[model samples]
Target: MSQPQAAVGAAVPRVDARLRVTGRAKYAADNSPDGVVHAVIVDSSVGRGRVTGIDTRAAEGQTGVLKVISHLNAPELPPVEGGFPPGEPLRPFQDDRVRFFGQPVAVVLATTLEVAQHAASLVEVAYDAEPVSTDISVADPADEPETYARGDADGALDSAPVRLDLTYRMARNHHNPIEPAGIVARWDGDRLTVWEKTQDVQGTVATLSGEFGIPPDRVRVISPFVGGGFGSAARAWVHSVIAALAAREVKRPVKLVLTRRQLYFGVGYRPAYEYDLRLGASRQGRLTASAHDIRTENSRYERHSEGVLQPGRMLYSTPNVRQAYRHVPLDVSTPWFMRGPGYSTASYAIESAMDELAHELSLDPLKLRLRNEPADDESSGRPFSTRRLRECYLAGAREFGWHRRNPKPRSTRDGDWLIGMGMAAGVYDTERSEAHASVRLDADGTALVQSSASDMGPGTATSMTQVASDALGLTMRQVTFRLGDSLMPPAPGHHGSRTMASVGSAVQDGCDKLREQAISLAVRDEDSPLYGADAADIVVRGGRLYVKDEPTRGETYQRLLARNNRSHLEAIGSYAGASESEKFSFYAYAATFAEVAVDARLGLVRVRRMVGVYDAARIINPRLADSQAIGAMTGGIGQALLEHTVTDHRDGRIVNANLADYLVPTHADMPDMKAIYIEGEDYEADPIGVKGLGEIVIVGVAPAIANAVFNATGRRIRELPITPEALL
Candidate 1:
């Protein structure tokens, strides 16, 4: 089939937008099977302790309460097999130990949700509390620090003409989606089916089956729609297992929805970080060496780490580089991946330091970055697949009027407010995973595609449908894409910006196979108009198969299939993995510019305008890509000025767990924002040539805002959520 230029790059409307906007999309909590009951979890109040005794008699006696299960009465579950950190996963209600505050201690199942909640409140638990350490500053490192060194960092720092030593802290942040994590589990004659809110339906099936010691085929997971993920729902949390066990014990389907307060504990959050950095540079602002000492928060049971040191190791051309990453186990739950994950956190520190270096050398920040750009990945000694970051900078500078701003701090003032512009460079590793999809072409000249991927607000269904439509030589209306079910073709988790490159590739592969099948049938049919035409000369367009040189000699797919007595043609699409020749480093790059106004007297910082120029290869839909950029910039504004998850060290409890206390960016806080994509494609990245966009957009944003604040006020705050108090 000849590739069409229209659908792939066009700004097509989301195919599922109507279903989502009209409230017709079915989320996990919307699924309710016959004879369903509600389950409520009872959490411990202590930060660190052991359940000494439990009194569940009152809860069991409550009306409609079917069972009150605690560690004392809960059935034993098989050990969880595999996880990211390579540790035994946490099992609910299987042990007396309480590793953190708000840990689920018991569950109450009843005929109604209200009764279950009321009965859960009646269940009493006794605990022997221990001194809790939630403070990163006071906690001891759980193990030896992980270290990486490239050259003689100490010698280079000592001999450099200029030096800087800085310490930066980022507060923990939570993923508070409007739709809370929920699960509805049912078991029929040893077969388990769960409707759970998750990014990976297939992974959930495997996890639940492993926990229950059942074959994978016996477990099915369905999550047709998800409200939002942002990485919190990437894995099946402990509550999912609790819900399934409760349903089995009750012998009926059970529904469990986490309350707002419970969400703060049940789902994962971005971990707090303390980064100590030392940089040595030449008088021209070229970096000579960088030494990073990083400390992060994690639970005592499982060590959680991200790619925190990656930015320092490979972002620039430093010859002497060293890194030490340590996890300080605290009385808190294990942190999971959030949007941008490690790269965003690391970018704030590195990019802010870069801005400082620019100031010290009296150089434009963009020019200083350009001077130090690496020709290859210094850490791995590999050439880049494609790096258009310089182009992004040029485009952004031209469009954003970057040259008009005065480089001197506190130079431009209007009344009580100071105006300044700042920019930062952003990078994220291009990631791809193996995935599979199934495509079918019906005699009616329509196509159906299926994959067990997710659409967590990135327009996965719409983009994939466009790809399928173009590849199958059909109109947008002739294609239907289905996802979020374990029974469909297998796909990796939809986090890490891999859904497009992985699942989309599979969809393309499937459509290509199906198109080939149709072409074979058409060429072999003696009654076809172009019966003697070579298969290579055939081109399918608008459901019509014709010889490339003779457009008029063609027949509709419907007629061809009907004459052949075929109902439909089907094929399985597969992406094996990244190519073996991928010796080149792959990443998506961006240049983020921010204009901010600061009130010196009131210590108020407000972003006035923002522009993001990105070099993410091959944007499937410009409209959806812009949405991703704008949303990420908004999140960066929050991270720089508002968002913080406060913990009370005395009890290890989250102080501002609710929306009212925790702040995010709202309409008033949104600045005049624009996003521009650099024109390009990286076929080495994937068949679709997309390096991914969701995470990279947010990577350098916080630092850009921070640098702008410094340029306005002449004061730098190394801590995140740079509050007015910090400026004062």
Candidate 2:
């Protein structure tokens, strides 16, 4: 808590904000390797089929057409592999069998992007088509769902004085980042180097090495900057491999980017959900029992399901609970993680149901939630490293003017709009994994810190640099922090908001060790100031070592190193020992508040304002954290009101594959937004004690807006993107 420490609970500006604002940052697509040739993929026209043959004569004959690589002439790759046993591995053009619609069948490399695109249309494909199952409702359900029970729910629900049963459905959504998913690959002899848009560079390298039967070291992956991932780039997809294959076949570097339409199938998305909830409560609105039945879509070749029921299992202190979660298998592309994935979906149902209970019991929603707040994690019975959900509500309500709520449907009206306010609680796990960093001190006294962590528009590089500077007693300008190449020290993948807790710890460790080395050298030198001071009593400031109680008596690191005739000092700091299992029970909590205006005639709903109060522990950079929290809240608005993926089902294909057809929120759609950060520490989680804020910022957003809609117009609509037709 000291002023000069630069420790936890301070709002610091991001060190790299200027680079991004000045347009100096570089993303994956920005890398233009010399001799790079553009490549375009050709996808299957049918939904499902067996490719009888491929005719590439016309495409191969075009000018600047290096070659058309398909199953016929494509070099053999190791069979696709999956870490999860039940899921199918994505095999790009490995055989004649086509699993789903728009699966890539071939790649055409050309001198220009337009030329390759034109050539891709010329290639001909013939297939024996088969009927496909795209709709989960029409498909047969799994015989038995994964069931977890604590107490009898049927009897409790029947006997309780208050009860509610409801179902919520959500549509598939795409991760449409500003920069399209693409890759640039170059082949040097048998080794391949790729500049790709990905969340996990190491995961990409390992997968590519396995696919090509090459050593992992031979494959290098770089993704320094990302436009916005939203979990789409969590793992390597087929497009990266397609580019590498094209480069190998053409004997030239290839730059392949998925077309907007191709992205629908090239990557994965959040699977659709249908959730049924049954709840029982006491007359005083203290909860009793709950039962949940949920089903999500997956591919016949793979089993995919989110931990969607997790929030319900622990968020509230319900007594008797029974839950059944099942995945309905269909012939469709497997789903991957999305922003707030499981937490967002589950919160919408549970929180909305809580709102309805409050109304039925004639009690305020905030009071109802406070009544059921658990002292510890109910599911695990572990004391929380920190639980601020109640604090988030109390503080948020005061800041958001919760007392001013009209508390009556359609009671507060402004001309043609019905105005109302609502709020909901949010939660997400504070995940951690093994990470490592290397710190090097040069003769000139400048320090270099390297890690494999990436900045996906979240200012990761900037925050990590701040960590190194503070720990090593160096000014921000003297420490250079580098990230994004697999060659750097290891780091956890940027997901689940774990980057800071995992990678920041690594940085702190590396810098602390490096600082210790400097101190040791300074103490041993007879020419250094305070030569006989105890090592533990020496503190560093501005790259200088001094006795703890005095400021004037100090020796610069450069002076000590030069007097000792040493060139440079180095150390490897690893926080890989920090894992989720041992450290602590960590999670970030948020309270989302929303105010909306509804049109009685048009059924148009416009969110007028939103406030998100978060308890994410120590914030490294207030400026960047504010932007992230607001951006996530804006994105959550889209999830609650505007975004939804459409499917053609007839041919088992996504209908709105492009951005234009698949609507996302633009600047005009955003409302007045505010983000509040709570200052605290949980040293048990990591050295930095910083819990994740990225995912939790949007966790409870949808439910808040949905509850607001009900308040504005006495209507309880459970499904997502609560459309005009439903209210009208």
- Candidate 2 residue spans exceeding 4 A from truth: 1-3, 7-13, 21-23, 80-86, 577-584
Distance from true location, Cα of 112 in model 1, Å = 1.3
Candidate 1, residue 283: how far the Cα is off, in Å:
0.5
RMSD of each: 1.2, 1.8
The number of clashing residue pairs in each candidate reads 0, 0
The TM-scores, one per candidate, come to 0.99, 0.97
As a TM-score, model 2 comes out at 0.97
* Candidate 2 lDDT score at position 442: 82
Clash total of candidate 2: 0
For model 1, the superposed segments whose C-alpha errors exceed 4 Å read: 579-581
